[model samples]
Target: MTVATRLQSMQPTDIGVPGPTPGDMARAFRSVRRDPLTFLEQVTAHYGDRVSFPVPGAPALLVNDPDEVRHVLQVSARNWNKKTVQYGALARVTGQGLLASAEPSWIEHRRTAAPAFHHQRLEAVSDEVRAAADTALAAGLAGLVPGTGRVVDVAALTHRVGLDAVGRALFSADLTGHAQQLLDATSDAAELVVRLGRSVMPTARWAPSPTNVRLRLTRRRLDAITAQLVAERRSHGRAGSGAAYGDDLLGLLLDSGLTDVEVRDELVTMVIAGHETVAAALTWTLMLLAEHPDAQERARAELAGLPAPVSMLDHRDRLPWTRAVIDEALRLYPPAWAISRRSIGPDSLGGTDVPEGTLAIISPWVVHRRADLWPDPLAFRPERFLDPGAGRSGYLPFGLGPRLCIGREFAIGEMAVVLDRLLTTHRVAVPDGWRRPRPQAQVAVHPEGGMPLLLTRLRAERRD
Candidate 1:
């Protein structure tokens, strides 16, 4: 039988499901505001793995099973579309960018943009990534007070580092001048999206209000900046060489015959997706390392053996422990916590019937931490990734299939370079009584209060 037909054949009772009551819906909404991860866990706890929640005028299914998530995101991708609520906010900032656009358009855009992230292309930019990381680390360490030894906010430092890397690599420009402004804009846009997401009902695009106005303004500001950069590149020809800018991401996008609006959307998507996730992953990695000095020392030892002027691309495969640390961090705190999709046709996932127009919610936050899948789900253990026999399905920091992040390699390379440089030069330690910050699930899972740490330059002997 066809997937849709099979879905129709199953009765609601047979699916072991019931409509979310009014009280349940109210509580669910409240939990979404206060703590979305907890809210999802509560739903799963109360209603089992394949539960349907009342989404006002729409049908929504929260799928926690790894197999089901894989099927929705990969196998039967054609049967799904990005929920308007999620993409509506993204569309405001991105304007039909690959991330926000659905189906054929998104596919075309991805195809056009894929070459820029090809292995050969990214290898050429590895030096830029390492240089940006070095610049960020040097600045961070220089800011350290002399005697008192003030604590550094590692999360903040890493965000700056990640932004610097993306700026230098993607546009071949320094973002230091506009970093704070861009960050503010991105953060504000994320908040506005979350607020707008909760309030927006599906298929109510025509209904207009203040939120719409703010979204438009935010989009305009972001686009205006991106447009200026593109215009500058067009006028300048190429950086120094003036030879038409070979294979950088910007050049590739320009050569793809995309309109200015389309280019801006992709740029915005890359900046946000590429930088934010790397920064968060780096922050969490350092935080975890700080709590485990042995792991920190081992990672440092790995870095010590690296040749001078190390490029993450060259050393990523060589440094097994370093890669494992990043994996563990992602497992604990995936920046892209929840991925949502709207079903275009009826389907049965994990044996539950989902009708057309249903919202399928796949949360890495829940799946990675499920006690059944991960032993001591809350513990910080990088070694789990090193186990050759370990199941990989439950771990998806960059996602899977055709829609997987194109910048995955770039992110890994950048992180490895930064960590190698930082750990080799300084000892990062958390201040006593410094509580780990709760993750604010906005656009990415970033520490709300910033990750604070004490950085002490390693003595020559200590380095050995």
Candidate 2:
């Protein structure tokens, strides 16, 4: 049957909105647990833009209408706070850092952290990103013969580049020594967060279940890393005074008068959230490029026109197509796939009244795929972004408004450097009938298995 026919067949929800009945939801429980993204897509197609979810005490609504999403996330943001199960689960690892904080204190935290991402600092970060990407690419491609290509797990390499970039640019430290431990700990924490978020009846944090025990161990590992970062800085007598400390984000936080505990929270937040998201974005970009060699070649052509000894920061104005490719990739696979907010006060979204304490779930994965907003939304066409007049009303890869990610510019720049270098140095391709990896959501939406692609190294002259 058609969407209109399906809508007509289903009765309106208790709040007079379109959605599945309790029985329908109960029947789809397995699908929801297996892949919430696909389950949400199926429901939104049937029910319409604003779908209400049945919950006993909490009134839950999935706001997919761009305008309504704006109302909840941007226009009337203060009315919707991040006190939902999503953020609550994340806070187990990040504490009250900016990523999960809902209190007014986050305002000060944002202000204090803003300078670390200023234009000048980002220019400096560009150098570090280029270095990190080059180092990672060199090591990862060391074994490949000159004329042949090998299957490489691009996801792992990008994660290394992202972590090293975050360490050097943000903290003025090296994280390679702790790379394996850090990656494992963050992975465990992300899986645990997803488990808690999806649990119908979440176990208390204090419980000694296997999940909780794993959670505690993961937190402790992360805390120890944070402590090491701080201790290393203090060893150089940079912990006490702003002038004595270096000018990276770590020093800035130390000088901002935050307690040692607050510093640890912010440090861990950046170390975990910052690198993982960038890595996911780059990994998806590479996969898309591999699938669309024409787009990859076009991006390489754009990069080829740049002057010799190119500086990504200084030559950014000449790389529109390169930037557009990254934009389209983000549109397809936004790292922060789902965003949740709880209403502190009653609000109306898309003409539907959202009662106080209602939960608003906004999935970029859903919104970015809306056919009404994007022309042929499922197709991978980076040219769509080339149109200067293209509207962003339905696009939100890095979120919207005040709580927008402060490191937006940094992340984009990091991806650009890696893409430019990789496209210039090697050819990215997949085997015949190669299927895209299934998207599995943990902390970020990542390919179920790592993204493996063939990388054929280009000659030295070709890179120039």
Candidate 3:
């Protein structure tokens, strides 16, 4: 052991500060049930960055400083795991997949899944995403009521596009017809699991409550669909005389020798995370664009100049402004709002002693909004990313360290594809007196209301 190890070996010290008592915890829970977003803000304001909350079980700490967050999530990440109440509940849906697993298992699965996200594989799928955008957009526009000037449910539209893109790119299947029904079930499941995690007396999943019953049904349907998809892929593999199957993500997982059960877990995890977060990000991006017409015009001008039937991945280097706009949108509304961890061993953070089994919360929502780290943190400015190192540590839309999202590249590529499609085709605008959406904090920070927007199709691109 080195001298640095000696510091960790020293006897653990108690956190020297005061925190919320049981009564305070009770009060916060009330707010959490009522309005979780506001509850978190109130907690931070009352307790400051390095806060501790004492409850019936282990204590909880909320760390906001970037350095401290790095310490928890990176420097000493090995000593922490996803055994917290939040993640335990999340596992109800995700099972032991990458998001909910720890140690050697997570390491093994990450290694298995890593190659699927390779730039080459993503490049192959980029065309599928491009196709998805075209189809989804044309359908949405065509479905508009006759004589209506492009009123749209932007939230639902983005979701449909995201679902279609992920389906084609990952499974090579069309999740077109039953996708929304499945998506609705999965979403309900997400809300239930999150509520269970936060509840002090979180009813056992097997409990007979209506939410629990719905969650059970939802899980069964999701499992059946994923199982069917995997079975179909396996049949394709068998039919090819044990030849190399297709190179979709499901193919990659099968190739890596993951069992059907393992494949199902990973697929469902992707469906939940990929489908919801991308849609939320796109919804917010369109909303932000509507609020800032100047940025929209600039992006459209850039997009209008691109060749028809554009391939974003092929010409990504030439679309800095468009990428910057998406980046800025992510900064303002990170989908994975709060990251929670449970300390396994004793450690000190920011000179404060953190005991074992402490619930460690690092919120990207709060961190991205810190005024000191980001000048006018609430403002929409895509230029921040135009500068190198803007995203190094302070920006955490994707997060940091070993557990960083393996799908980061995939998410960015998909977002770029959708953004290019929408900006090139239409100008999104809000209705008169449309109030800005309130950021709702759950597993992700998403808009409170399903965003409604007026879309005006851009003029035909000038042929060169």
Each candidate structure's TM-score, on Cα atoms with residue i matched to residue i, is 0.90, 0.94, 0.91
Stretches off by above 4 angstroms in model 3 are: 1-14, 143-148, 239-242, 308-316, 460-464
Q: What is the alpha-carbon lDDT of model 1 when measured against the actual structure?
A: 0.77
Q: Considering lDDT, which of the candidate structures 2 and 3 is the better prediction for this target?
A: 2
Candidate 2 total steric clashes:
0
Please report, in order, the local distance difference test score of every candidate based on alpha carbons: 0.77, 0.84, 0.77
Worst 10 residues of 1 by lDDT: 6-15
What is the full ranking by lDDT, best candidate first? 2, 3, 1
In candidate 2, residue 52 scores what lDDT?
85
Model 1, 93: alpha-carbon shift in Å?
1.2
Q: Clashes in model 1: which pairs?
A: none
lDDT of 2 by residue, 1-464 (tens): 54233423543337787777766766777689889999989989999888888776557899898888899889999998999999999888889999988888998999998989888888866777777787788889886655678789999999998888898889987788888888888888889989988876678889999999999999999999989998888788844444646678898888788898899889888887888899999999999999999999998878776765234454357678888888889999999999999999888887777678989999999999988878899888898888765648988888998899888888888888788778887889996668889999888899989998989987544333
